[model samples]
Target: MRALALASLLFFSAPPPAAAVAPPRDAYPDVARAYWVELDGKPLWAGQPDKRLPMASLAKLMTALLIAENADLAAKVTISRGAQQETGSRLGLRSGDTARAGDLLTATLVRSANDACRALADWRGGDQPRFVAMMNARAAKLGLRNTHFADACGHDAPTQYSSVRDLALLARAAMKQRAIVDAARLPSFRFRSGAGREYRMNNTNALIGRYEGARGLKTGYTPGAGRCLIALADREGHEVLAVLLHAPERWWDSIGLLELAFDEAKRRSRR
Candidate 1:
């Protein structure tokens, strides 16, 4: 009886699990509305993972998904006036820049280029609105109730939103596509035009080059959405997927959560 009581006390007094990264979540209080970590096939940790919120450029993963499904990267898409004039980050495509679909995809996924995404959408769906409808349809097919796309580039909109759960599903799905996995994981890519003009795109996700084992998915930010990130990493045979929504210190939070999750996965393997 005495030994059992002593063991119980020690167990109760033990420190928190090594996997709970304790992100100074309060320091960046309003940064993320939700975060989630998953390993192998099971959830490791979560905070408000199902809460819906604006998911800025993270929405482009869906756009990349649709593009990968319906078109070949070598296919050429002519930039329309509408595509040329999209707001936010741009690849500086002219009104008539005839770029290969693959080049545009590189710009969209690596640099979060709004103009490139619009061009891809127009090529894929005949118009931006039609492409957005396709995005919603695909979301429904994937059983994502909290995700919707008003635009292919993840621009701020009253109706556009997603939860970390849905985004994680989207990330894993996107990574399975060869093109997205290639582009999202790169640090930079140079796009050369038919006219010999060159544009270099820098990755928007800070964690890609900075974090060990970080592969990628996407990054997003808007005043309404805060900071959103879907980061992926693979070690040995284990895969870790992490999502942070509306977080200001998203890079640190993501690194902390991922390292913690990786440690947990290692411990689980021993068990």
Candidate 2:
């Protein structure tokens, strides 16, 4: 009984475990100027998140979001001459081509097809400018304070701009839509041209198949925008959204940023 009492006293008198120290934020190398936000049960690391920059193809996220919100995916749309003539990262769709809204959306999101995006906008909003207005409206509704849309296909325009933080919000909102998520996550997809030619389209978001836990997002580049990426990844019940703007090497920067985010999340989870 004396021994037991002594042991109990010792246990009660023992010091508590040492408090955990957080990893320093500077541990991650400066790969690019970036803005990261964790949402829907995730974490964020941001830099100059509100600085507006040309979005390039990442603007398609907004286009996809608008299409998913306003149009039935199964609806058919006739490809216009204007849509066919759009340049940059296209599937070579021709004028007078017709395809289902779902297929066009798949092309737009997975392949970053400029022609497909323009077709979707024309079909949904009756014209490119009107569609851009809708995109701006959607941005307003989403509370994206630093975003503006000048074109539907992310073609270079003086007014087309978005910040990393704003794009993160857009990506998060788009992920909530099943169709958008499905289209974004595909490694590769097929779209039937207006002329019934089969075109195999691959995702521009290189991280989808290359990185563990990577799902969907977008990539962009222009002489003005540099290289940009909005990347999403899921791991161990945690989701992270990372955005890089004007990155000299987008793929390398994105991978580095994601690695940092995952490490930070894990470190916090153990605390």
Candidate 3:
């Protein structure tokens, strides 16, 4: 009888294995190569967040910030040969097409248009080389030591890369601009060029309208970068931001991180 009681006590009192419970922050360990989670501007959890990696279209977030801070949004930008001819995602602007800085800004944030991003950079930096230099300079000022931009728009490059930690800072700065948040959150936009051509753009971020409490941010993917996301959410006044890098399951992982981050924040506050 005493042996039976001792066995029962040992079985009941022993702690459960770590895997028997959900991962901390519900981290998508299989896909999330590196990530950073923050609630109310306090670090909640992370995984190798300082590891520099290709950011892909996430580069546009920084471009949008610099333009928003340094240039006049209403200024007219005459589409240069380079802006119209750039490869990858584009607004389909012609070499002679004209647009305001604000319009290109919106397109870059919403649709991840490579052309729109280049146009904004060209207009503000006067040329790509100059613009890239400006991007680096801005990074220095922002104290993003792990960030470097090869282009205004995220294109896979040997020198272009950013860490999850560095990108969260960039996103935080970008979010301060109401226009950027509006553009990111916009469900869809129909932009008519000065050439009288209509171009319809849609948000590439899966979380924009589908995820409850989600706010404006960005998404990125490339063969080299895999899938990346900078996501923001506000749940009952507990605002959370998450940066996931090289995630094969970016949308799902990001949603999980955001949801869990908020849950953790609430749990702590209640304690």
What TM-score do all the candidates reach, one by one? Answer: 0.88, 0.86, 0.89
Best-performing candidate as measured by lDDT = 3
What TM-score would you give candidate 1 relative to the actual structure?
A: 0.88
Model 3: what TM-score? 0.89
The total of clashing pairs for model 3 equals: 0
Candidate 1, position 228, lDDT? 84
Instruction: Please give, for residues 1-271, the per-residue lDDT of candidate 3 as tens digits.
Output: 2334433432333322222343324233443678887778876667777788999999999899988888888888888889889988887788878988888899998889999899888888889889999989988988998999997899899999999889999998898987898888887887677888888988999898899988779988888888889998998889998888888767766666676666666666776
Model 1: residues with Cα > 4 Å off, grouped in runs? 1-31
Give the per-residue lDDT digits (tens) of candidate 1, residues 1-271: 2334433432333324434554312222232578777877466666776788899999999999999877888987888888889988887888876888998998898899999999999989999899999999999988898898898888889999999889988877787789889888999999777666788988998878887777887888777888788888887788888888887667766766666667767776787
- State which candidate has the highest TM-score: 3
| Winner of 1 and 3 under TM-score | 3
Task: Pick the winner on TM-score between candidates 1 and 2.
Answer: 1
Show the lowest summed lDDT stretch of 10 residues, model 2.
15-24
Query: CA lDDT of 104 in candidate 1?
Result: 90
lDDT of each: 0.80, 0.77, 0.81
- Cα lDDT of model 2 by residue, 133-203, tens digit: 99999999999998999989887788999987788889889988999888888999996755678989778
What TM-score should be assigned to candidate 2?
A: 0.86
